[model samples]
Target: MWPASMPGSILHTAEVPAFDPRTGQLSLASHDLISAPLSLADVFPPEYTLLFDPSPSRPYGTSTSAADADQPAGQSRRKRRRLARPDETASPLDWIRHREKEATRSSTDKESDEHHAAIEAELGTAVEAVRAGWMGKGEDAWMGESKGRYEWREKEDEDVKEELDLVGLGERFAPALDEPPEPLLLSESRSTVSAAALFHRIVRNDGSSCISLDIEVDASEATPTSKATVILPPSSGFLLSQLATWPASAPSIASLGGEKGGWDVLIVDPPWPNASATRSSSYDTFDPYDLWKLDLPTMLGDSPTLVAFWLTNRVKFRRLLKDKLFPAWRIQQSAEWYWIKIASETGEPVWPLDAKHRRCYEGVLLGYYVPLGTKVDLPTLPQNKVFLSTPIGHSRKPFILDLLRPYLLPRDRPPNVLELFARMTLQGSFRRSATDEDGEGDQQKPGIFLAVGNEAIKFNIVDGSAAAGSVRGWLRRQEDTERVCAAEEAV
Candidate 1:
């Protein structure tokens, strides 16, 4: 059914409106922000063990709601529990009782309904406007190809098994080059000596549209893990491939944050321990307090950095970011936003606004960060905003870099960004990766922008070729290794 309200134009803005009748804050379409040119394995079951080296964990301290505890020796980091909903799976009599119980709490129900109804009205109208703009007026509309839900639009897929052993790619590294290489750093190593050599084989290109990149992440072996080609979604797709080789001269751990004069923007999405996970074998979450180990303040660039923290609906997590996390980093929490998951066909939130088990929206907390002594002026932050996107892959969020671009400092070039605890990625990271990394002075004009993550690239270990056959994953990085090596030998 068509929405009751006619679609209106959506204004993607940088500054928060003093007061606008239509959706108090800026609302955007997630789809338009992340229109990747190719299809990709939307979700890669997180294997936290293989990510880049993390700072040494700090001594556990006593804090309320954030106890210092460790996962049992032989257990997984994620916790799982069952949610019993009599309304969804209960017997006819039980269902009646559940409904009756709800009716008995009239005041409570009325207040909740009224609150959510307002959210629905405002958010729904904004989403329809943006979605319609992207879907277009007629024949060029994206939805024309699909009468039902788009196969690519759904958030998660059960059949795409993500088992991988990246080490296998060592065999595919480009044959030892005959000439001396450029300066290289050892800190970028993946797993072991073999993995480091494999990383050396990675090839990067900052010239393409940054809409996408084709890297051969071969997962070959006799066991369950085999070789498979992957298609990473836009921005991230292009950025991660370049990040694979960007750190040839990266600074040390102590220098990571300020070395580049701190990141102009930092997007942190901590995988807080929760009962809801696509699969138990996916990401490894930690106690909320452990996030302190990251020491984010150290990661900031010298200027004001915009921080976007993705939060679950849980109030405790919200409190953690606003009260504890923000204060710790001297970040001034400014506004709250929402990322609503909608159905591709209807542009309606996939779930009811007030669903008890889970709301159709996730909360996003935005803030401006400047260290205690840093004197950079902060920009006015946006308020009460929401971006709507159809879900894809496991917890894969829409690429938000472009949406956040307006707030980036300098306004001349893109912000130097950091994606802390990033998984599949904070979308659109790669769009600017192709730019010269010689810092703010580089005269290179901005082309397109994209994204990357700590564990941004994943290989399923199945046998096959990818769409971009011209690209070779086996390309080698020409680096001047500081350490001596035995003469190259056959694998």
Candidate 2:
């Protein structure tokens, strides 16, 4: 009889089969057919592999033996041994010996549980005190009390100045601390010329003016990648490479001037702090002085024209710009440009709000001042054009070139233009560096620092001359010629 421990216990006593090629069959015992023997061991790993490894499979029969059935409660059964080879057999007594330890372990667990029960009964009373202490609260835990007058409070943030107590009441009267120092303005000189004229100068100076001059081809004749680094000249007819060039173009103004340079009109956009917005969300850094700290004071010193400062609608920024930034730069108010940014999506008057007589418009304060020697004509100061006013796009300003054109173009012109806090380039505008000192080609393009087409952008370089050769001289002569011509006509 086959042992029940083996799954699908077989009782085969058949003879071996031989293949018959002619009939395409096999002779097993006596008959032949097409079927071939497919052993169970061929379909699955042998039972011996499962036994030695003690693998509990779902489909296969249990590995237990008769010793397992007779084992005591809680006793684990020993797996029935598998034959190593078909010819090998196992003794029944071997199975009983393997399950012996499991039977002993079952009996020991039963005795241990009985002993644990007696110990629990003896210790039960002590456990109650432990539970009570954990659950109890102190007498003062929730005691109610009236609110005290001595309680601390947050101080009101009022403008009233407090009288501080002095160490020696009579002798040590403290003078109020000096008002906080103002924002430092950029006093370093930057030369400002017409944005268009500056663009031409760059073109002529770069020698790449030929490409722009080549009228035969369309504007997009050259692939953007190919012509991105065309060289040009400074607006001053100075042999310096155009600010729009590749590797050679990415240097500082200090490096550009070698030692000395100055600006006529200092246009600036200070990154003043906005309390309502987070640093990341706001296009500006939280630190208002960051713009001043960038050495602007040294950059805007006593230029011929004014410093146009863009201020947000904030009390703090206005104070810094008026009292601190402009003063430090030696620039005074010449005029103002109001940029009313309307929302493109919802063009319902973005700037002007009748509520506070507030327009959706922001202000660009134009401050003007001349250095010790240079002369400027206030009357002739071109009406400060409304350079840029458009609906707001995250951080976009209106294209201000049209507004700037009048002030920039003179009867007798001047050289080069300088743009501060610019995103893109005007054909002639020499935009301030917005990238790493060594970064090439206006990293943010089409927005600022764009190259100009071939045009004769005339400019007069101021060389400390009071007469015709300088910007002031040309202005004086133009006014004189106009007056003389007008007088002759009147006569």
Worst 10 residues of 2 by lDDT: 31-40
The TM-score between candidate 2 and the true structure equals 0.34
The lDDT per prediction is 0.42, 0.30
Tens-place lDDT per residue, model 2, 1-491, is 11111111111112334344446786542101000001111111111110011111111122256764676643332232421111134456654554563466554344433433433322222222222322233321111110110111112311221211111111222222232122112221232222212221222222212111111111232211111111112222221112122122213332332222344344555445554335345333336665454444343343354446676755456567678766765655445444433222221234323212133445567666545565666433322222212232233333343233344423222223444543222233322232323444242211112221111111111111223211210011234434645897999
For residues 350-439, write the lDDT of model 1, one tens digit per residue.
Answer: 665545545777777888887677676666565556675545444555545656766666644435555554444222222233232333
Instruction: List TM-score per model, in order.
Output: 0.54, 0.34
Q: Lowest summed-lDDT stretch of 10 residues in model 1?
A: 47-56
Candidate 1: how large is its RMSD? 15.9
What does the lDDT come to for candidate 2? 0.30
lDDT of model 1 at position 423: 41
lDDT of 1: 0.42
